[model samples]
Target: MDSQTMRDLVMYWQGVTLDDEAASRLAALSTSVGKTLNAVAGGSMFDTEPAHYDRALIAMAERSDD
Candidate 1:
């Protein structure tokens, strides 16, 4: 997309106007997702313990009726 179209889409997703600082921060975060994926591919320090991950699917299912 052209810069103007991309800016419009970003503003829409942000649900408000994008000032310079906020726009830059969001763009930085967008770039970080790819960096995180690359780090995960190399193996993550945060993934050492399986028990640290909470699989709350059963709780979510029970709460769905409420």
Candidate 2:
């Protein structure tokens, strides 16, 4: 998934504005997942499944102690 697309998804799910820093972080995660999973740009590549995305984001948040 592309960075912007990921950021858009995150923001859509949370219904919140992701600041530059946060968007960057989300974008980075998307990039990492894309690389790891061989996903290309756009929405179809990476894991965009709502439940999985939420779980992954929660896991990441927990990992960061946020």
* Model 1 residue 45 CA deviation in Å: 19
Clashing pairs in 1: none
Which 10-residue window in model 1 sums to the lowest lDDT? 51-60
Instruction: Compose the digit string of candidate 2's lDDT tens values, residues 1-66.
Output: 555676788778978777677787888887788687664554463554446777678677744544
At residue 47, give the lDDT of candidate 1: 59
Give the Å error, residue 27, model 1: 0.7
For model 2 the TM-score comes to 0.40
User: Judged by TM-score, which candidate is best?
Assistant: 1
Candidate 2 positional error at 39, Å:
8.6
Once fitted onto the true fold, the runs of candidate 1 whose alpha carbons sit more than 4 angstroms away are 1-7, 41-66
What is candidate 1's lDDT per residue for 1-66, written digit by digit as tens? 334444677778865777666666667776788788888778655755554234655544555557
